[model samples]
Target: MYDRKDPYYKKAKQEGYKSRAAYKLKEIDKKYNLYHQNSRVLDAGCAPGGWSQVLLERVKNGVVVGVDILEMDSLNHPAFHFIHGDITEDETVERILEISDKYDLVVSDAAPNTSGQKLLDHVNSVELVQKIAELTRKVLKKKGTFLFKLFEGEDKDMVLKGLRKDFDMVKVVKPDATRKNSFEIYVICRGYKGEQG
Candidate 1:
């Protein structure tokens, strides 16, 4: 659990960010150069609008469309659109496309609720991440960027194997904002090459 007095939590409040998770993306983007000022971005599993909020500041005139099964307090920006639906559904993809044909970057900080059984939690996280990856295939532009979080497990290699064909480089990183006791790792994929025949 996040300590209310955690430095990041306090920092978030002072900085006007919706959640302390905002720092993770800020740190990741600084290292990876994830999105451009005029880029189109899709933020899946976005709620409370922290990552989406950061994207809004960074994208400038670009657009950020966030989707989640949980209702998000609407982001008050002309360039920000929220799709309140499960990203695994066809309807969500259709709604995302209605805003733009494709996105220049797709990011997901979303994770499945952990049940405390490490193996069970890891398996569930991988499955949810795979579904998000499928969404990336549908909405990401050629040569786009894909970033997401996953629970570390024995099956992570299999996930990486599938991504090798679709992206030029795939790497995993743990940001400082993540609780040190946490098992979550962020996968950063670049140079999307699209589906292999």
Candidate 2:
């Protein structure tokens, strides 16, 4: 949990960002430069619009489409669009495709509602990440990038191996904004190799 007195928390509030999670993307982009002006981006599990705000600022002339199961209040950014639906649903995918044919970047910060059972949580998280990866293959442009959040566990190796088959470079990254005690880490995959037959 972020302490209200912490510098990051204060900075986020002062800067008008909805949440400190915005810094995670900032740090990742500092390393990967994932967003480009006019790039098309898909943000999965976007809620409260923190990451979407950062994406909007980075992709000046670009478009950002964010999807989440929960309703989000209006973001008021011309470049940003939000869809309220389950990303795993076919209807959601169809809606996303209607906005753009190929996306340059796909970012997922999704996590299953935890049951407080460690093993079960890890398994569920990995499964969700895999589902996002599969969706990335279908929607991403050739050579697009995928960034997703994952929890470290025995199942992580399997997840990384599957990602290796789809991306030329796959790296596990832990941003400074991520809590040290948390098992959460972002999997950064660059250079999509096309759909698996």
Q: Tens-digit lDDT track for model 1 on 1-197?
A: 76987999999999999989999999999999999889999999989899999999978888999998998788889899999999888888999999999899999998898899999999999898899999899899999999999999999999999998899999999999998888999999999997657
TM-score of each: 0.97, 0.96
Candidate 2, poorest ten consecutive residues by summed lDDT: 1-10
Per-residue lDDT, model 1, residue 115, is: 96
CA lDDT of each candidate? 0.92, 0.90
The residue ranges of model 1 lying beyond 4 angstroms of the native Cα positions read: none
Give the lDDT of residue 82 in candidate 2. 94
Model 1 RMSD in Å is: 1.0
User: In model 2, where do residues sit more than 4 Å from their true spots?
Assistant: none
lDDT score for residue 179 of model 2? 76
Which candidate tops lDDT? 1
TM-score between candidate 1 and the true structure? 0.97
Error of 1 at 47 (Å): 0.3
